[model samples]
Target: MRIVILCGGESSERDVSLASGGAVARALLERGHEVVLVDPAAETPVLAGPLHFGDVVDEFAVGKEPPSGLGRRLLQERMEGALTAGPVLGLLRDADLVFLALHGGWGEDGRLQERLREEGIRFTGADSTACTAAWHKGRGQAALGAAGLPVAERAQWQPGIEGVPQAVRLLLAAGPVVTKPVADGSSVSVHRVDSLAELERVAAETGSGGVELLVEPYLPGREFTVAVVGDRALPVVEIELSSPLFDYTAKYQTEGVSEVCPARIPADFASRLQELALRAHEALGFGAHAYSRTDFRCDAAGEPMCLEVNALPGLTATSLLPLAASGAGWTYGELIERIVDLAMS
Candidate 1:
């Protein structure tokens, strides 16, 4: 099968996406599939020749901050122009499957998926509608809540909106609040605020940049994630954060976090987590053979509450989906192969 892996977009997760794309390309190549890696945001989109794992590993040596200002503007311009470029579209149309290794921005937010669908190209994971619903944290939480899934109490705030601070103050009255971009991945710009002053500072700083934010009561229990591939939920993986929040550095840098696969919890609890994960996936309209990863955190009562569903979960070395897959007795190559098979089916 000929597969074109899309990675490294104009989003904050560009480096992480490159790492995922490289790792995926290598796995698919080892499985005897024709793999081509394309960074849609690049000046020359197609990444020719075989991928070297060493080079790929270096791509994600990301700093604590995301790309900004001039660099980001240039990349956005290139991404907008490159997607419709003849070479890029030709590769997409020619491939048997276009595996999305992208994480945030337009790539994972449904815009790119919609374009591909309009061009009559097949891609892995959920369709544009599902992606759109899942990409927005508030929207996804609403859908999950409507489906009777437990979700943390949350309030939404856009930049420059009046009375948002008051609402956030009300939410924070419950306890320390977690704030993050309403639509983002890799935990970019995520922060935990325990004081009104700090919350004000965070809101002011974040809002000044025109980013929408969601504030929710901070869950004080264990953190876990479940990945659903096709119709099956893989084993649960527990996250142990070295910091108060699972920010960008903690996610990509190995030392800041530890993940325990098949999380060492009671069998019933794990089963419940898996069930909720699958239910959340379905509630978001993900069809058969679609894949997603649902994140959770236990509340003060130790009951699990849904955080958000990753429409296109990362496949990087430290990514939870592959770790959960490993716990389910699937090798890295086998996991990639399974995803390809599901997409082609």
Candidate 2:
């Protein structure tokens, strides 16, 4: 198959997306599939590092350049262009399939998917409608919770300029709440606020301008993520962070953090999580999501608290999904193959 791997975007997650593209490119080639890596605008990409997840690829990352050499350069050149899909959807005209690794904003939040739909292109993962539903943290929470799934107590702000006041009030109500760009992955702009003062500060700091905020009751539980490929959950992973929380730094900082697969938690918790993950994916009308990572916080009673899901989950070598896939006995190449198959099928 001729595969076009798209990454790098105008969003804050550009670096993370490129790293995912690198791993995807190598994995596709190893599986004997022809590969072309392109950025969100569909331009050729170049990075000077090991290209793994969380290596401080640039200033945006921590403060280090990933180990570099032949591997980095080779991955950089495997693609025809490194531009984002925003401008390069034209370039994908003749490709067999588009495998999107772009995370956050327009890339993952359904903008690009809508464009692909208009162009009548074949791509991996869910469509624009499903993409939008899954990315909107508050909406996903509502849908799942209504379906009898366990979700943290939460509220959503309305859309439009008038939405600002409603947003602040909601934030205040969900106090000791965690604020984030509701549609983003990798937890960008994610933070905990304990007082109205801090909550107001964060409300002003939010990107996407008056975009709805997902304010959920701060629950106490272990954060575990379930990575689902197609309709199946790969495995469960428990996140252990050395920091106060698994913010962007811990997510991409790769220094001392570790992930325990088939998490140490009891089997019942894992089963419930996997069940809810599939239910959430289905609820979104995600006909063919190639990769899905459902993040949750399990309370002291082992009750799984549903968080948002990542439809086009990261592909960096050390991402949660890859870690779970490894435990499932699927090599990097195998994982890529499974994703591409679902995406193009």
Candidate 3:
């Protein structure tokens, strides 16, 4: 199969996406598949051969802070015809399956998926509707809550939106609240606020930038993630963060975080987590063969609460989806092939 791996869009997660794309391209190549790497945001859409994880890893290492000015750059690129450039569309139409290694921005937020569907191109991961449903944290949480799945109390605030801050303040009254972009991944711009002053500052920053914010009661318990491939939920992976929050640095860098696969928890508890993950996936309208990763953190009562569902989770060597797959007895190459098979089917 000739697979085109799309990555490195004009998002804050561009570097992370490049790392994921390099890893996926290598794995697919090792399996004897014809792989073409494309960075839709690049001046030259088609990437050269000999993709290496180390190349991207060293060049675009995720730092302690998320990349800034990407939101504006994304808007600028779109206006300049980034994803819809003739070269990118031509490559997509020629592929048997387009593996989306994209993380945030238009790539994972349903815009790119919608374009692919309109062009009649097959791609891995969820379709446009499911991607849109899952990309927005508030929307996905609502769907999960409607499915009777446990979710942390959350509120959304946009510029000039009245009454949202009041609701967030109520949540803050209970405990510290976390503020993050309403529609983003890789924990970009995620901040933990302990007081009204800090919340106001963060809210003001987002408001000035015209970005919507989602506020939720901060859960400080054990962090775990479950990846669902096809119809089954893979083993849970526990994330031990050295920092207070699992920010971009803790996620991509090797220092501040450690992941324990098949998390050392009671069988029943792990089973419940997996069940909730699958339910969340289905509630968001994901296809039977589509894959997604659901993140959870234990609340004050020690019960896991759904955070968000990732329609196109990262595929880097350090990514939780591949780690969970390893716990389920699947090699990285096998996992990549399985996703390809599912997409082709």
TM-score of each: 0.95, 0.82, 0.93
Candidate 1 vs 2: which has more lDDT: 1
Q: How far is candidate 2 from the true structure (C-alpha RMSD, Å)?
A: 6.8
On residues 1-345, what C-alpha lDDT tens digit does candidate 2 reach at each position?
Answer: 776777765556667887887777777666666666665332344233222323322222322322222243343333213333333545566678887877776667787788777878888888888888888888878887887778876666433444445545664674567777667677776777787777666777663455566776665667888888887876789998775466776787688477899788778867877888888778777765556788888656867788877878777766888889998998887888887888766
Error of 3 at 14 (Å): 0.4
Q: What are the per-model numbers of colliding residue pairs?
A: 0, 19, 0
C-alpha lDDT values of all predictions: 0.87, 0.70, 0.85
lDDT of 3: 0.85
- Candidate 3 lDDT, tens digit per residue, 1-345? 778888887888888888888888888877777778888887776775434333331334555565678465754474248556576788789888899998887777898889889889999988999999999999989989999999988988885566456788799999899999998899887899999888878788765567888999999899999999999999999999988898888898878899999999999999999999999999999988799999999987798999999999999888899999999999999999989988988
Between 1 and 3, whose TM-score is larger?
A: 1
Candidates 2 and 3, the one with greater TM-score: 3
lDDT tens string, model 1, 220-274? 8889999999999999999998888778888878899999998999999999999
Best by TM-score: 1
Better of 1 and 3 by lDDT: 1
